[model samples]
Target: MSISLEQVHPLIGNKFQIETSNGIMHLELVEAEERPRRGVPESFRTPLLLIFAGSSRQPLAQDNYFIEHPSLGKQVWTIAPTLADHAKGQYQRPHEDGSTCLYYQVFFN
Candidate 1:
């Protein structure tokens, strides 16, 4: 099965384990969004883009990681560390700055 965001939408708000060089880490699917290009013609379906957010306690290096989900199995994603959203408040863990989670975004078409 392809590892596109469309295949993973059902697992939103769920946590999945990712195999990393450091070991296994977990990422929680926080949100998903699809935005059409402002100038794209209605006939162009491929122009629609999908984006989703995954939160994890352990920050990841800029690279692709194969994440495993109980139901969805494993899929590769290019994970890039993003600033923690202050709006979410403190997460389950405590970080040096007292904020517990960092975020990553996955993009697909």
Candidate 2:
């Protein structure tokens, strides 16, 4: 089944796992933003932007991954490595986890 913005919005800040050939990488959903409406105006489901943060100590390749959540089940999505903030640098995640790392984003549009 396709994942919708509504299904994931509430799960922000929760832990999610990404399955890669290297192994399982742990990540946290850090940001969610509703994108501008498209297609059938407001009647259509708005696109969404979801950002996830992972450990900076390890390397995370950009690829399609099967993301697993405790309650959200499993869904595959294409995730690309992105900057947390251009001014601040892309690799370091802007979180208070006492550690900084690279951030990844998934586009629902």
Candidate 3:
């Protein structure tokens, strides 16, 4: 299912347990901070990006996560059960009527 950025931002740095159709997905918002880079031209400026994700079990595993920024974009990442398993989905976008919608599903089992 899809969730809004506003709805999820407050939960950063906290543990989250969500009930999915297949099973429970345990997520922990590890760290959220502004990523800084040096070497870029002074004319370039990056929007504030926030990162959030779930803890993993594999050795040296990378956390399942998402990155969001007002101007850049939003992205979600999760581990695949196998190379053959790939799912597609979409995210929420606000409408002219001020209504929000979310339509996405990512497999993490």
Top candidate when judged by TM-score against the true structure:
2
Error of 1 at 14 (Å): 0.8
TM-score of each: 0.65, 0.77, 0.28
- For 1-109, candidate 2 gives per-residue lDDT tens digits of 6567778889988989888887887888877888777564765567889888888765577788899997878889898988776664555444555667678889876
Winner by lDDT: 2
Order of all candidates by lDDT, from best down to worst?
Answer: 2, 1, 3
RMSD of 3: 15.8
The global C-alpha lDDT for each of the candidates, from Candidate 1 onward, is 0.62, 0.78, 0.37
Model 3 segments beyond 4 Å from truth? 1-9, 16-23, 41-75, 78-109
Off by over 4 Å in 1: 3-7, 38-57, 85-99
Which model is ahead, 1 or 2, in terms of TM-score?
Answer: 2
lDDT of 3: 0.37
Whichever of 2 and 3 has more TM-score, that candidate is 2
RMSD of 1: 4.5
> CA shift at 55, candidate 3, in angstroms?
5.9
lDDT tens digits, residue span 70-99, model 1: 988877877776664566652353533444
